[model samples]
Target chain A: MNEIKIFSPATVANVSCGFDVMGFCLDSVGDEMVIRKTEKKGIHITHIEGFNLPYETDKNVSGVSALAMYNDLDLDFGFEIEIYKKIKPGSGIGSSAASAVGSVFGMNELLGRPYSKRQLTEFAIKGEALASKCEHADNLAPAMFGGFALVKSVSPLEILEIPSPKELYATIIHPQIEIKTSESRALLPKEVKLEDAITQWANFGSLIHGLHTNNYEIIGKSLKDVIVEPHRSKLIPYFDAVTKAAINAGALGSGISGSGPSIFSLSQGEETAINVKEAIEKTYSKAGIEYDMHVSKINTKGIKILN
Target chain B: MNEIKIFSPATVANVSCGFDVMGFCLDSVGDEMVIRKTEKKGIHITHIEGFNLPYETDKNVSGVSALAMYNDLDLDFGFEIEIYKKIKPGSGIGSSAASAVGSVFGMNELLGRPYSKRQLTEFAIKGEALASKCEHADNLAPAMFGGFALVKSVSPLEILEIPSPKELYATIIHPQIEIKTSESRALLPKEVKLEDAITQWANFGSLIHGLHTNNYEIIGKSLKDVIVEPHRSKLIPYFDAVTKAAINAGALGSGISGSGPSIFSLSQGEETAINVKEAIEKTYSKAGIEYDMHVSKINTKGIKILN
Candidate 1:
């Protein structure tokens, strides 16, 4: 094929108790990229839309990820990419990861699908590293592979797709504010009490068990983040109020989406998801903060080909 | 019924990466308890065998656990318990947990099974606290519930059972030595580097996923214990050599069993379990350390009723 267009879903990383190990994809919010095969031997971004992201081939996530894939394949042809970003930048909902994953995913399809999903994830991670300074696959893994993913190890690039319940829904709220990734990360303590670490891992293990077993009560109980949330929630406005309201409204679990400004919750059905969204809206309205909310089922199809 | 007899399986707590939250039960090694109904209002231990344990109701785990159950039920009739301890004390293979779990389990049956498994576990933890001076349900949960269990929260007593593969086997080598739980626990650092803690939680998450998905390779990769094993392994003789030998013998994963003088390895089949046992025997033989080895399938039945 001469050209390809792909839709890469936004991802929720950390998942509270899981910290850096767990994440899941959302169906409604994401970034779209169109890639066209070109005669030239180098990648280029021909156009950009929506969010004002860097368009430089080396600087942009899409461009860098596409370039990484091209170099890995030693391709004879290059690609011209067009970006249409729907997910907001610095929204703590994996905006950069969608761009990075969508670029390599679309490029690989146009290049005869030369790489496996895990291999493509490696390229996407290179793009993610450009934005965050440290490499992490929590967002990119779910973005490429769809559904809930566990980043078992980064050195060998081991990623496992966890089976989630069919009726699981996601409610996400993006408050009109920005939290710098580096600044949010800097708020965390360098050392953690061993007792807290045990509790965190126990919750993480329970969360995984809940996903596999489809136990909503266990999932709700396991969603607590005693380590990172207690420290980072101070930076987000109305964090406690919003979370408490969502839980009261029947959301299975609620927490900051990635860093801060955006918060999300998981529920069993669309009604509960909508209820959670209304709860979040009510909470934010009381605080007089403008927000954008989306309620959707978990995106089982991570990156999709759009003609 | 005049009395009820039960067999409570031995357990391996911590399970490498899981520390205070994870454990599994074994079929071949355990403790047997017999509980007879009595008209007295207070529980008592009438007899003991195979181990030099206290017969006083308050001091003995079996008697203490039976007492907890009686008090919880507010029952007029009491129980007279006899303990048959087959699992060696202080071998780091959850010897005390078996007794604690077996006592409550048998007492519950004699009392017409009024308590749920979780409720019974609560009584067992009371017994465990009498020995360790702290309440922990890691071993007791698995001993009472069967197979692999994760103690998500100790306060409200949340335990989740993880699915295990049908052919999973455990190879345990118990060296004839004693390591006090308090002494082993004292070796751990109160604070852990956040980086190591993250790695640990990642491994723990991966291990749970592996168990639920029946992915052996993932289990092998995630069985590493970076937190407690490093400190506790120093107390066990031939810990490193035995572990290395078991891994080399085609075992999927190997590590110290609990705060161990006993080391265990997980494998997929009988052949690998046997091979691991032979390898451990060879290692201990060279070191001239007396050891007892048991190779068996994962215990699907935690506590069994015996006529």
Candidate 2:
């Protein structure tokens, strides 16, 4: 297969109680890419569309990730990439992750699937690091492996795939505001009270159990971020109002997605997800903040091939 | 039932990574009690053997817990309890928990079990607080609910019963020394680093997932304690040596049972448990510390009835 077309998924990381270590894939929003084999010996970003992104191989996330994967392989030929970017950069819903995952996934497929999905995640995070300035697998793992992902240990690069409930869906509302990763990170305290840490871990353990058992109430109750959200939410306009509206409209829970500017809620069904979306829209409309929204099923099969 | 004879198991709390929130019941080590319905109007401690403990109802853990349960119920008749304490206090394993759980469990049986295992945990913590000086459900939950238990929250009392792998076993070594709960608690920092908290939650989530799926290797990997052990281990004699011995002998993982002095290790099967026990015995002997040790399977039934 000289040429391949694929759809790469967007992801929500730091999922409420699971800060810096957990994430889930989304189905409705993503980017499409076409990767073609070339005689040249290095990665080439031949075309880009729908987004203002650099065409240089080292500067782009997809190209960087593809290069990371390619450099390890003793291949005779190189690859040219065409990105049809749809997910916006800095949306806090893993926009860069989509592109990073897409290129590696496509290249791996073209090479007749030499590396495992987990290996692909390792490669993707190299590209993810270029954007976040930190090596984190929370977004990359979910985008590559699909469903819910738990980054057990980053040093060892262990990613545990958690099964998503069949009816689970996500509603994302990206308020068009830029919150620099460094700024959001700086707002957090260097040290947290041990009492709060215990509460956070308890909720995190319960959330994992709830996901395993398909208990919606437990999931809802456990979606609390006592550590990061309080400080970071101040950066976004009407954060609390949007979350309260989503919860009142039947979302299982709501929290600032990733580092925020975008908010996310998980609901048990598509109908409730749509309700959550409409509620967020109403709240954002009242707040007079420009926003983009999408309702998506928890994508069980992450990056998909497109003919 | 006019009179009930029961076996309430000892429990190992803070199973490595699950500090302050997780625990598992033990099979071979526990306390026995005989609870009898009496014409008396209040709790009476009639006979005591094997251990010198307070006989007054309010001062005694079992009496306190029984009273806590009794006060909630408008019982026309009071109860008498006989103590056959085998598990020693200040052993780090849940010795007081056995007594507390036994009284309430026997009373619940006599009263036709109005309270669930979860509710029993609530009553048991009332007794546990007398010893620990704080409301912690880690020990009580496992002693009441059986298997492995996750104390999701203290307020509003949520206990999530985790599945124990069939082949799992515990090896416990109790060095005859006193480490006051207050002193042990004082050893902990009021605030912990954010990076350490992330590692802790990641391990916690992985540990819960491992328990659910019966993945022993994953369970072994996830049983890491980065938060509390560093300070607390100083109080225990041969802590590092014993853990090293246990690990070298094929135990999955080891840590301080609750606070200090007593150490526990988990292994995959009976043979490994015995090996771990022998290894710990060797280490403690070399250190010349007077110690008591037991090897037992993970008790799936928390408390049991004896005719």
Candidate 3:
């Protein structure tokens, strides 16, 4: 149980209507890691890239997570870790989850891989709560296990794997704008009508059923979020145009990704994915917002050991 | 269109954690009706059995539904319906839905059955709302269409068909106690923490996935309702005993049946179903509540034509 090279995928939490409980992994959107053994008795923050991440253990999300696991497990092993942070931060794409999960995964191997992926995800949430001020594993679960994941319970941290169906493509559009979690969260209303609440639950119920049964048409109809999107879509530039454009381009459905500034459109085929990306970028261009596009398949394997 | 006969089966809404969106049919637990052509050009209801039900057009859930379709569609024929109410009222099962959907289904046949099952369920909701004051087709969806169903969105009324799933048996326990829908609904809280809300969604998501992938274990694991169960369980005399008894009797999972005075247990086989029924009855006996039991396979068909 010495040095280990592993990978943790980036996740899109809230996958349209799944807010806080549903998430899926991306093959093309994630982070990579390399872990090496040292004679020293503790973890060392070796490297970081692709984002201006801090190295001062406290400011380094990945570093702090590795430290937490080491302390919590009471292990006296030495390791140096290098992280390749490919996904951008503050883009509503679960950047913090990538770092925390990546650290836990790499370190778990250095400690004999005693914990399972589910265990690693649990341990990772402890670090995320410190960074996010609330214990949220919506992103972390998918990042650890890949595919479609659900957090059955939180206090004890129950993670359940959702069966992923084929022929699904995800198109992501990063508007190159920053929307902090705090600001994004503030836009939601505290109280909702009982009617709205029931509606949300009903739609959410169908969305889960669709994902479980691989009923794509149902999934398309169910990917609507009334609670947050109405309020938060205002924060993203050309949110409406981007959504309309994605649908026009053959997307089964489109909605704000996670907290948002980053928008995602889901389609049924590869061609639809390509069309959605093109449409999204075009919408952003029309709205005068700079954007980057990525077309990907749903990654079923979340974290993997990369030699 | 010529006169015809249509049947809508009884349904079980809220398959444990699904609440307002997930529902399924119980073939052995349902009702039946027969609609025949008449020269009278109006609506008439008769032949309700097993318990007292309203016969007046406005007061009858089923009768009102038949009238709604007759008025809305402006059909040229009259219908004489004989409802064989097999499932008892106040059983926490979709008793009222059986009537509502049953009427729509029968009338649809008389009008050449132009409306799809989804459309029929929508018409049924018009009747359900008149009785329950909420526009929910959770029960009707499963009733109109066989197997497990979800009413994804109700405005245009989107329906998603989920698998009824094998390796599962339903054991329903009727305590011979009545809990009105309005009284049962009064127990819920106005608001819940985001964390609890997330758990509800998670379990729901897992249940959907379980049904799709035919993962019974995950379905059992996901059988939880944080929002309604906590508040409603207090009304049941031996709530914990019934569930514990059922689980101890080889049941995979168990929970309250919609606005329950009745409890339902999910078991793996015939043996477990028998055991679960005994356990539920025993628990009720210990609590001094009168009861009866029905052990059944998940019914896909709604009401049927006895003739």
Candidate 4:
């Protein structure tokens, strides 16, 4: 192989009510990958763009994914990789997933598509596990399947790709403040009582119904996170205010996207998307916090090859 | 109005993870209601079969629903109602819902159909509130809409008739040890930790996904309840054993049906249904408890006016 070209999209993990067990990848933007064949049959990472970070392939996200691919399959193919990063490292927009998935996707192209998409995802998740510090597949799934997904159980292991709903818009607000996923998770209690759990299921069920039947109102009403959001919400300034504004601005639903500092809102159309984006920005402004927000449709396509 | 006939079907509430907020009515097999015009505007009840009781209308389940209709409309129509109680009470098969919905359906026919099905459901839920002492539409929605239903929010009062999934069969096991709905409510905890609640939502979402996509494995895996099932299950003897046996018997999913004494298992076909029934009965027999079981489909039609 002489040259390999690949691209991976940013993913949204733990989409509201799905908690640790769900994710979806977007098509609008993510990290870029450029892999070139080398004389040596080992992975080498050369360039990283868009954020301050290290250049070592071992520490690089793309490098980690490439490493997992090399380690899993006893193959020697020397490749120099360059990463043009758009999504940040810890923005909760699937930074780790982007890198890991990028490497696997790039390698698949270089190896003349030896592994299937599922196989690439498996290796990508391994890289993600090391970087995200959790044995989760929410980000990995969307990176692989490219749409709404559900992780039924982790131990018995099931990942389902739900069809991308019609009239789906993604509105995200990334506050400049940093809240690590580890800290967000640490705040959650070890055990929960029985009553609240029932409500959670009810909400979850309604959300799924909303997705299937295109009942946006039900989805909006049912988007509640009893697990991570309540405790970790304190870490993010004006979390409630931003969500309230999004809902008020006619967003179908809004909640903490992965481990905030980033909040994502779903809207029914472009009009609502813009409205929600403005609402979120205004709310953050009121709270005296600088943030980045984007209003875009749900990415029907996950990753693409650009040669 | 003279010689009016109305019908309401038996309903399945709780739907695995949706404890108190989901329900739908069955078709063909339910309660029958017949109303006749009398000389005076006074109400009289007769022919309460299956349960040994006197025929005073107020104490009757049909009478409760009738009362709501009569009160809500402010109408003066002397009526005689004969209720054919097909679904047995305290069976955890939504017997009360059948009667309640029957009342609304019968009265609507007598009044020349003044109310919509949703309106009748609202009236019917009031009757359920009287019977179950819980403010929920779990049984009523099913009684009105059939198939799968969602009680969107219990407080602000929303009941949604969602899609009834195809290729889904319900296996209900009715153990003849009476535990009232109030008693089940008393057993459950008032509050739950945030995290467990979120898992419930994830399971719930997966359950809906399974229903939407016709994926049985996901439904089975997502049938877990972290809240009410753990605590309230203690009240039902052999609850754990029956659940284990049902799963082992190739049922896709198993859980206590509503506020049981009754356990419900979900499967894709007749073979799984038969196996679940055998497994459940075996457990109950070992526990020395008398019980009955049924393998039924998700009844799509809500209710019908049987001539």
lDDT by residue for model 4 (A248-280), tens: 999877777778778888889889899888877
lDDT of 3: 0.77
DockQ of model 2 vs. true complex: 0.89
What is candidate 2's lDDT per residue for B1-307, written digit by digit as tens?
A: 7999999899999998789999999999999999999987788999878899999999899999999999999878999999999999989889988988999999999988899887887887898788778888888889887899999888899988889999999999999989987788789989999889888999999999999999999899988889999889999988999999999999988998988678999999999999899888877898777889999999998899988
> After TM-score superposition, what is the CA distance of residue A296 in candidate 4 from its true location, in Å?
1.6
lDDT of 1: 0.88
lDDT of 2 by residue, A1-307 (tens): 8999999998999998899999999999999999999998889999999989999999999989999999999888999999999999999989999999999999999999999998998899889889989899898899988999999988779999898999999999999989987899889888999888888999999999999999999999999999999989999999999899999999999988888888999999999999999988988898877899999999999999999
Better of 3 and 4 by lDDT: 3
* Model 1 misplaced regions, further than 4 Å: B39-41, B74-76
- Residues A101-162, candidate 3, lDDT per residue (tens digit)? 98888877776778888777777887677668788788898888888887766778877777
Clashes of each: 0, 0, 8, 10
Output the lDDT of residue A210, model 1: 89
Against the unseen true structure, what C-alpha lDDT does each candidate score?
A: 0.88, 0.91, 0.77, 0.75
Ordering by lDDT:
2, 1, 3, 4
Worst 10 residues of 1 chain B by lDDT: B69-78
Predicted candidate 1 versus true structure: per-residue lDDT over B1-307, tens digit per residue: 8798888899999999999999999998888888888898688888888989998889898778877877777767777888888988888788889989888888777767888999999989999988877999989988999999999888989888898888899999998887886788789889998888989989998899999888899999989989889999998888899899999999999888877988889999999999999998988998877889999799977989988
DockQ of 4: 0.54
Q: After superposition, how far is residue B14 of candidate 3 from its true place, in Å?
A: 2.8
Compute DockQ for each candidate against the true complex.
0.89, 0.89, 0.48, 0.54
Residue B168 lDDT, candidate 3, scale 0-100: 73
For model 4, what is the alpha-carbon lDDT of residue A304? 77
